[model samples]
Every structure is written in structure tokens, then in C-alpha cells.
Target: MKDHVMRLAVGSSARGWRVAIACPRDVYPQDSDSSRYLLEAGVKLIPLSLPGRISPHGDLMAWAGLIRILGRLRPRLVHTHGFKASMVGRMAAATFGVSSGYRPVTICTVHNSIAGQFGSGSRAWNLAKLVEKVLARSTDGVIAVSRALEREYLELSHPSAMLVTCIPNGIALERFISVPPGGGGGVRLPSDVEPPGDAGPPGDVEPPGNAKPPGDLGSPGVLKPGRGPVVGTVARLIPQKGVDVLLRAFPLVREAFPGAELVVAGDGPMRSQLQALAGHLGIGARVAFTGHRNDIPALLRTFDVFVLASLSEGMPVSVIEAMASRVPVVATCTGGIPEVVEDGVSGLLVAPSDPGQLARALIWILSHRDEASRLAQNAFEKVTSRFSIDRMVEDTCLFYQEVFRRKAKQAACES
Candidate 1:
């Protein structure tokens, strides 16, 4: 989500959109990457308190804050991301307009299916559906990051008055593609692209201390080396990501190939629990839990096979990043994953939460080096052709214009 925001803000600002992001102040402190990136990209940062979970008091305060912010900024559009932000932002926009007689068009981007994240009949899921249903009357437009999410939203109780479109997430291909061979090193940005302000060139940025460049993994298509093949994944250690499932699958992977190592990057509430599970499974030494990395492109270069065992995803950026880096992918066939990875052509897709299947996929990728490389190449071509930041930005800007024009037409007709 942070990555999407950063890319979108920068891309929009570069295109002269006068972008401003409203997020929790404490969550993105002055020293945080999100803050630094937005500032560098010349996007205004509005520090608004928004609780991640439901809290009557906190939500009330957040809603009031959003109302104040909306009144002050008087933006032409109030684009919200995430569930909590969308609910609060849309209501605030509507309320602010009623009181001040100046309402901004509201657009909510749905990144994931609520039912997939929270079980279909779960309280959170039901609450999300209810909120979306209620807000549909006021929301001018909706953006789904994946086709699956688009279908989910269409099936949900949204009004026909709203316009919903799918705009798959895209990345700044230069950042991932220019990662120096062998791994851990600064990326070289294209000469045409300049670094923002005094932030310095992105190409000069060095990899983290832990991500050492690895030697060649033997022959072109073989996985045998002095050190075992590295199977890696970058995702928050949360239940939704199904990292535990990956841990359970690792033992089976090790059974087939003893030296196979797993590197789980990114941190969340489940980090300690997942670490313990790795120990209990007796693969403690084999798995390295590097929490929250900034050098993902460099880290990706070290992976022999990239895996995403997510139980659900809305077209994971990590999978795209891995593909862009020309690494073989093994991800679950859930959410919009099948949309990104064509099974057997670009990458391998297995059933989610099935450790046995996950392990088998990982082992197969490890053993069949030639096929994996071919898949990796195919994935690279797909990402290069389809998922570029430029395309996403263009599509988003067009959508914004279309929604704004439609709103204007509706208001004029009513008047």
C-alpha cells in the first residue's frame, strides 16, 4: 500500500496534479521512508489521524479531522486508499460538502477483496460490505487494482451511478530492472529521469548491510552451489500473507534439498510467532527472518526462486518486482495472482495454504533450472510490456478526468 501511494503520488505530481496525501502522522514520521519519498517527490503530506481498526472514539476524531482538512484544502477530488481511510474520507467529503456547500469528488481505490482478507461472513467483512453499500450513493468513482477485485466490487451492493474500473498496480520498472547483476548494489536510473530536489540520485543508494552479493549458482540451469539455493519472499508477516503456510512447506522443501534456505522479509505482528514456528519445525537455522527491508530490488537479485504463499492478494507488487528482476516465481493461485502469472508460461502457481503443494512447486523450480529460467524470462517480458508506472498513471489521470466531468454534468443537469 505504501509503495502504491508513493509511486502514484510521484507520478501524479510529475504530471502536474497538485497531489497531497493524508495519512497517520505518527505512522509516517518525519524520518520514515514514506514521508521522505513524498516530500522529495513534491507531494503535500497531510498528517491526519486514522486508526487501522474500528474505534468509535478514534474514528469520530478522525472523521472530524478529515472534515477540517477537506474544508481547508478544498481539493477538487478526495481520493482515498484502504478500507478505514475510504470509509472515513468519503463520509467526511459528503458531510463537509453538505455543511460548506463545496464537495469534492470522492474516489476509493479497492486494493483487496474484503471477504478474502476477512472471512466471508466475518464481522469485519460484513462491516466493510455495509459501509461500501452505504457510501456508494456518495462515491463518484471506484478503482480496483485487480480484475478480481473489480468483479468483487461489482457483485457487492454498489449503485449503478458509480463508475468502477480496474487499474492493475504498476512499478517504476527502472528501479527494479537496473539492479546490478550478482545483487546487493546501487541501482542505475535511466539518464532521462532525474532525482527529485536534494534527495540525490536513486542510483547512488546502497543495499542494506545484510544483503551480500552472491556467487553464481553453478551452471546456467542448475541450482547446486557451495551454499544452498535461496528461496525468498517479501511480505508482511500477517495471517493474510500465509507466511506460516510457507514455513510449514519449508520442511518438505528441505527434505528434498537439505541445503535449501528460506529468507522471509518484512515484519508485522506475526513475526515472532512465525519465527517460533520455523524453530518448532526444526528449520530455524535454515530460515532467516529479515524484518522490513528497503533494498528489495537488491534482495530480489539474491533469490534463486521467489515465492509468494499469500492466501489472498490483489496483484502483489512483490511478484511483479521479482518478475521484473528476472527471478523465477512460485506463487499461490488466488486473488489476482493468476492475472499476473500465467501458470506454466511466466511462473508456477499452486493452491494457497497447501504446504505440500507449495513445497512441491518450490522443489520443482529448484530442480528444473532451465524451465524456471525460461519462465523468469517470460515473466520479465510480461512485466516490461504490461505493468509500467507510466501506464498506471496515465490510466488514473484519465479516470479522474472522466469522473470529474461526469460529476460536473450531473450537477449542471440537476441545477
Candidate 2:
């Protein structure tokens, strides 16, 4: 969610929009690095005491806060991302519509499918669908990050699906593209495309794999010569990411690539458990838990293969970054992954939560260097051509204009 907002905010600012961000105060503290970054980027932050869960009092407080902010800003449009923000932002826009008889355009970007996060049969998931159906009337337009996510939403029979515009997530291409073949190592993009000096490294990744530490995996420069392959993934240590499956699969991968190293990036609640599982499998030494790091481009360059063993995703930005870095990808076939990775073409895809298949894919990528290189080249070309920050921003700007045009047409018809 932060990535989308950061990219859009930066891109939108470049396009001459006076963009101000209103976010839950608790979620994004005023003095936090992220908040400071946005402020420095000229995207003003309006922190509100928004509630995390469904509470009548909390909801009332949040809605009132939004109303106050909107009333003061008198912005022409209110853009929201994710489920909660969309709900609150849409409600506030509706309230303004009722009182002033002029609703500011409300645009929403749904990051994931309702069913993907919560199971299809879950009550919360079904209730969310119902709510989306009800609130979508207030939304001027909806943006789905991928076609698969759009289809998943439409399957719920929500009319909002008709209103959705598909736009795949894009990264600041020059960030990854500028890095040297081996790592960042002082390499730089053209002056025009370079990001601010303080923007820092993006989050780097992948799921867990097993092996006991021969001595201390944390120790630097401890690896033997010809450590074989280094497979990396940049993902939160969470169930949805399927790190556990990666851990289970590592043992089999070791059988083929004996000195293979698994680099798991990102940190989450499941870190301790995942670590224990790795130690239990005697592959802890082989697995490196990088926690959360900013040197993702550098990490990608070090990887022999990049893997994303996710159970669900809505066009993962990490995958795109890996592709942009020209690393061969071995990702699980789930959500919008198939849309991005063409099996045996751009990259290899395996079934979600299948350890055996994942191991095989990783092994193939490591063993067949030529095939992997071809696949990586194809992926790099595909992402560079189709998924650049400029392209995403242009599409977004066009969508916003389309929504305004549609609204104007409706007003004329009513009159």
C-alpha cells in the first residue's frame, strides 16, 4: 500500500497535482521515516486518528476527521487505496455530496481481491463484497492492479467490476535498471531519472528454505568455495507469502544444488517460527534471514535466482523489481503471477504451496544457466517495455480524466 501511494504521489506531484495524503495516524506516525519521506517529496501528510477495526465510535470519529480535512482542503478529488481507506474516503465524499450537493470525484485502487486475502467462504470476505457493492456507487472510478484481481472482484457479482480499470503495478525503472550487473556499487542512472538522494533502498526478499547452520549463518564470509546457487526472495514472513512452503522445499533443492543458499528477506510475525522450522530441517545455516533491508537492488544483483513463493498476490512489486534486475524468476502461479511470468518464456511458474515443484524450478534455473539467462532477458525486456513508473502514472492520470468525463456526462443527462 505504501509503495503504491509513494509512486503515485511522486508521479502525481511531477504532473502538477497538489497532492496531500490523509492516513491513519497510528498506522503512519507523523514523525516516521515514511511520513518524513513523503513530506520531503512535497506530498503533505494529514494524519487522522483512524481506527484499525470496525467500531461504531471509531468509525464516527474517523469519518468526522475526514470530513473536516476535506472541508478545509476543498480538494476537487479524493483518491483512496485499500479497503478501509476506500470505505472511509467514499463515505466522507458521500457526506460532502449530500450537504453540498456536489460530490468530489472519489477514486479507489483495490490492491488485492477480497477472496485472496480472506478465503472465499469466510464471512468477513463475503461481507466485504457486499459492502463494496453498496459503497461503489459513491466511487467515481476503481483501479485494479491486475486483470486477475479485477476478474476475482467481478466474480463476486459486484457492479463495481464494470467500473474498474486495470493498471499493473510499476516501479521506478531506473532504480533497478541503473544498478551494476553485480550490485549497486556506485552505478547510477541518467541524471534525469535518478531519485532523490534520501529516498533510501526499497524493501528487499523471498520465502523460507531449510538447512542447519554449519556454524553461524549470520557470520559474514563463511561460505565455502563454489557455494553453488543463491536463491533469494523478498517477502514478508507471512502465511499468505508461503514462506513455510519454501522452507519445506529447500531440503530437496539442497539434494541437487548442495551448496545452494536461500536468502529470505523482509520480516513479519512469523519470523521466529520460520527460523525454528529452518533449524529443525537442518537448513538454517543455508538460509539467510535478512530481516527488512533497503538494499533490494543490491540484493537482487547478488542472487543467482529470484523466487516468489506466494499463495496470493496482486501484481507483486518485488517480482517486477527482480525482473527489472534481469534475474531469472521462479514464482508460484497464483493471482496475477501468470499474467506477469510466462512459463518458460519470461520466467518459470509453479503451483502455489507446492514445495516439490518449487524446488525443481529453482534447480532448473540454477543448473541451466543459459536457459535462465534467456528467461531473465525476456523478463527484463517485458517489464521495461510495459511496466515503468511513467507509464503507470500516465495511465492513472488518463483514468482520472475518464472518470471526470463520465461524471460530467451523467450530470448533463440528469439536467
Candidate 3:
């Protein structure tokens, strides 16, 4: 979410718009290094004491605070992202006390559908869906990250569906494109491998430039002098990611290609359990767990193939990022994944939670070098053409302007 906000801020500012960011204090501290990055990037940071989890009293206070801020700013537009921010921020804007101006063009970007985050059977999911339905009617405009998500919102029978537009998430493509494969850019120092304990918490790493790969496509095993083909996945060790299924599928992949190595990046609560499972499968020695590392671009370059064994996703940025790095991908055909990864066209897609099919896909990519290269090239072209940050910013600003234009006309009519 922060990535999305930051990209918009930077892109808007580049186009000569004054952009400011308002975020929960707990999540984004005022003195943090990340806040400093925002400040340096020409974004004014506003911090609020917003609660992390659901708290009726805390949310009420936050809503009051937002109303006060909106009243003072009295801006022509206000946009909120995510479920909590959309719920509170839109209501606050609707009720903000302003005597002499037209109502602001308040908009919300729904990043995920209620059913995607929580299962359909949960009471909380049903309640959230209801709230979203009501809120949708009050907002001036809506942005769903994918067409599938837009369909989900329309199914709720919200009148605001007419105001909704689908804009797939975008990333900084140039950096990924410029990244050097493997060890060509420079020799990575030992210290760079493991940071000092004093370093701040992990975040996205900048792309390493012009790195070279280990071996040529014609080389045997498609490996470097002493290394095997690395199959990697960057995801949180959570059930939603289906990391367990990936782990289960690893051994099967190993059976076909003994020299293959599995690397899991990112960390979460299931870390320990996953480690135990790997050890039980007796493939722990071949599998590497990189707790959390920011240098994803460099890591992706090192991989022969990337896998996303997620049970569900909303157009996963990780898969897009991997494709941007020109790494062949094997992702599950769930949610908006199929929208991004076209099976046998740009990349391979397998059934969700099916380890056998996933293993087969991985094995096929590793074995068929020419086909993998073709898929990677196609995937790169697709991402560069469709999911660049510049395109997203242009689309978003157009939406804001269209909404504001309609709003100004409505006010003129009343007068």
C-alpha cells in the first residue's frame, strides 16, 4: 500500500501537482528513515494516531480527526486507499463541515475484495461487504485494482459501480529492467550479504545494476560453473501464499532435477513451521530461507525461474516484478493472476493448491530452456507495456479530473 501511495505521490509531483501523504503514525513513524525518504521525494507527511486493528473508540476518534483536517484543508479532491482508510476517510470527507464550497471529490481505491481477504463464510466478511456497499454510494468515484475486483463490487449492487474504473497496480519498471544479472555488475561484498543488526527493518531493496548471469542458455544444466539452477519465490510465509504447498512441491522438483535449489524469500508467523516441514521432507539442505531481504531485483536475476504458489491474489506485484526482471514465472491461476499471466503465452499458470501441477510447471520451465526464454521475453514486454507507473498515474489523474468536472457542473446547476 505504501508503495502505491509513494509512486502516486512521486508521479503527481513530477507533473507539477502538490501532493501530501496522510498515514497512521504507528505504521509510519514521523522520525523513521522511510518518512525522511518521503520528505525528500517532495511529499508532505501528515501523521495520525490510527489504530492497527479494529477498535470502535479509536476509529471514531480517527474519523473525527480526519473531518477536522478535511475541513481545514478544504481541498477539491481527497483519495483514500485500502479498506480501513476508505471506510473512515470517505465518511469523514462526506461529513466535513465546510460552509462556502462545493463538496470535495472523495474517492476510494479498493485494493482487494472482501471475500479475497477473509473467507466467504466469516461474519466479519459479510459485515465488511455491507459497509463497502453503503460507502460506495457516498464516494464521488471508485478505483478497483482489477476488472475482476470491479465485477465483485458491482455484484454487491452498489449504484456507484457506474463511477468505478479498473486500474491494475503498476511498478517502477525501469529499475527492474536496468538490473544486472547475477555477478556481472560487481563482486558483492561479504558484509553486503548480511547487514549489521543496527540496520532498520527490511523493505524493498533497490535494483542492483547490470548484473550478469551465471551461464549461457546453451550451457549444460543452464548453470554457472559450480552452481545449480535456482528456483525462487518471494512471498510472506503465510497460508494465503501457499508457501507450504511450494515446500511440498520442492521435493518433487528435486527428484527430476537433483542440482536444483529452492530459495524462499520474506518471512511471517509460519516461518518456523515451514522450516520444520522442510527438514521433515529431508530437502532442508537444498532449500534456503532468506528471512527478509530487500535486494529482490538482484535475487530475481539469479533465479532461473520464479514461482508464485498463492491460493489467491489481487494481481500480485511480486509476480509482475519477477516478470519485469525477465525471469520466467509459474504462478497459480487464481483471482487476478490469470489476468496477468497468460498460460503458455507470457508465463505458465497452474491450479491453486496443486503441488503436483506446480512441480510439473517448474520442471518444464527448467528443462525447456528455449521455451522459458521466450516466455520471459513475452512477460517482460507485457509488463513494460501494461503495468508501468507512468501509465497508472496518468489514468488516476484523469479519473480525478473527470470527477471534479462533473462535481463543478452539478454545483453550477444548483446555483
- The segments of candidate 2 whose C-alpha lies over 4 angstroms from its true place after superposition are 25-37, 51-57, 160-162, 184-226
**126-182: candidate 2 lDDT, tens digit per residue:** 888888888876777888899998887666546642367799898988989888876
Worst 10 residues of 2 by lDDT: 196-205
Per-candidate TM-score against the hidden true structure: 0.90, 0.86, 0.86
lDDT of 3 by residue, 156-237 (tens): 6466423778889999898789887772322232223433222111222111112122233332234443455678899988
Q: What's the lDDT for all of these models?
A: 0.83, 0.79, 0.77
* Better model by lDDT: candidate 2 vs candidate 3: 2
Per-residue alpha-carbon lDDT of candidate 1 for residues 291-404, written as tens digits (9 for 90 to 100): 878899998998889999998888799999999999999889899999999887788888888998888777767766766788899999999999999999899999999998
Q: Rank order by TM-score, top first?
A: 1, 2, 3
Find the number of clashing residue pairs for candidate 1: 0
Best TM-score among the predictions, by candidate number? 1
User: Which stretches in model 1 have alpha-carbon errors above 4 Å?
Assistant: 31-33, 185-220
